[model samples]
Target: MIDFYFSKDQGVKVTTVNWRIHKLAQEGVITRISRGEFTLGSGISYSPSLSNKQISLYRKLKTEFPFLSICIWDTSIINEFMLHQPGRFYNLVEVEKEGMESLFYFLKGKNMSVYLDPSPELIRRYLSDEKDPWIVKLLITESPTQEVNGINTVTLEKILVDIFCDELLFDAQQGSEMDRIFKEAFEKYAISESKMLRYASRRRKKQELEIYLNDISKYRQQPNFIANK
Candidate 1:
């Protein structure tokens, strides 16, 4: 809005207004809310902390299947955005589908509770809230991931999409809590909507996710956005 006024009333270039906005944010005068959106609050970024168990499990899988693409992350990462976070959290290990069964057995051999691509029925029948378990799942091809401490981990974008799509698996992050989750996620992280939509498309939930995003966010329908990465 400031940029538009400057351009129309004072003949200032959009580039100059943008540069000013960037400099103002750098100096802490204004906060960047997505691309051009601005606010008074400070910026927040998402960073996942890896547990020893998560690290060790990732290493074992990497050593066993060095060529496979695997991502490891803990569900407790959502605690940063929740008021009713549960005491029990679990590990999520996603890899290509072909090696899923073998990896499940390998993990099972270690005497830890593990499940492979569980159904809602399986979750109800066997998954225990009293204990932490590792779930082996099929990693959607080209799902956004990053390497943290030399281990591949889930990105904020992927987590948002997963929670939106998997009601049974991510029951903890649903209903009213889901609204808060998405609102906090957008506020606290540099997430890319395009990347998230691509993953959702792979999961066949792109359209649904888009509608949900529109319902929850004002910036979701922006014509342009500068991805913060």
Candidate 2:
């Protein structure tokens, strides 16, 4: 049956096979131990069932959406780790979205650790610290606003305000770090004072607008005088 469904050169209706396999698993005829890419059951272990083509597609999607975050779903088991370690896996609980079903499917097979919902305070602390701009960008862009298991998306203005507020408490080194991140974000995201103010006005925080206006002037006037070789 497995060979009939999964033969490399054969044409088989994947949906039909998937449904049949799922039903059998649920009925105790087989055990499902992983995501769509792999499965294991009594007296059988499927080794690397996903095709090389599918693996290539997955990598393409991940590369294209580098800012895509798994934390936005309020999954209690989700945790962020250093990007250097590809071997690590983390389970994210409380994910209800259909899109996340794929992520959960992959993580379950890897047997990774899970972390609970991160507090707003912790997120705020990270924003202030300027330690991880990629993370900050992901949080602002991907967090859902209002829905079951939704993550709250921060406005662009709010992001600026948060960074500014954090910088007030920073020392020299921290200030340099903030400068580096802000410059990078500004260049990468094409951020401008006008764009920031537009978001700030919607939130009814004119004070924030005033601060940004001041900062923008200072940022613009800094001599771009690069020494020529």
Candidate 3:
């Protein structure tokens, strides 16, 4: 683990240290494994490294709204879990509730393919064939995320929760495909069920999701699979 210490002789304030830590995390110089804790190495996980354009947009928006939480990721990441591949992928930008409207308008005025919490109808009408459609939504509470290459992106846990709960938004990753995703994700990455369940509880789906996950575990012939892993 990378331990961060503040020194008074160097005249570093707590806020300065905090900002620097966030900066280093954004640049992948360090990794935030949990709240107020960091470690070295890339570690096994699912997190997208944003493209330059995506990072630039995030930086600009963050500067405009410093206190707002933001997360961006490409839909291409979902292709791995999709049985029927989507022709065009989207760039989703999720922001805090209070900043959603303002940011959406600002991005729209700038001629970006920006939309505010697109519905299934709107997605089919405008975003289906568009190249890199930028969809913005209000960030859900307790959503898990990771910073990669100076930008915040959704973590695997968040992705799994979304795939399970959001049928409209993540329609492509359903039924048997959902099973495949869960199986592949657990096998390929080191997932924290505690973190996932905490976030799912915030979404009010913890019990049901837990039941579903347990069923999947039993089906896989690995009872108490996730917690044990």
Candidate with the greatest TM-score versus the true structure: 1
**CA lDDT, candidate 2, residue 221:** 28
Candidate 3 residue-wise lDDT, 1-229, digit = tens: 1133433335666677778778877987656666654543343666665688888988999898889999988867877756678677778898889889999998998998788998889977877667878888879876898888768889888988878887777766788888888887766665667677888998889998899987876443322123321
Instruction: Please give the lDDT score at residue 178 for candidate 3.
Output: 86
TM-score of each: 0.79, 0.28, 0.74
Worst 10 residues of 1 by lDDT: 220-229
RMSD of 3: 11.5
lDDT of each: 0.79, 0.37, 0.75
The true-versus-predicted C-alpha distance at residue 59 of model 1, in Å, is: 1.2
lDDT of 1: 0.79
Clashes of 1: 0
Whole-structure CA lDDT of model 2: 0.37
TM-score, cand. 2 vs. native: 0.28
Ranking by TM-score: 1, 3, 2
Which stretches of model 2 miss by more than 4 angstroms?
1-110, 113-116, 120-174, 183-189, 198-206, 209-213, 221-229
Off by over 4 Å in 1: 1-44, 219-229
Writing each residue's lDDT as its tens digit, candidate 2 over 1-229 gives 4454766536767777778877976876544333332222242311112234334433543564444443322111111211122222211222324434455445434443222233457545553443322111122332222222133223323444444543332222134444554443433332334444444455455576566555644443222211111
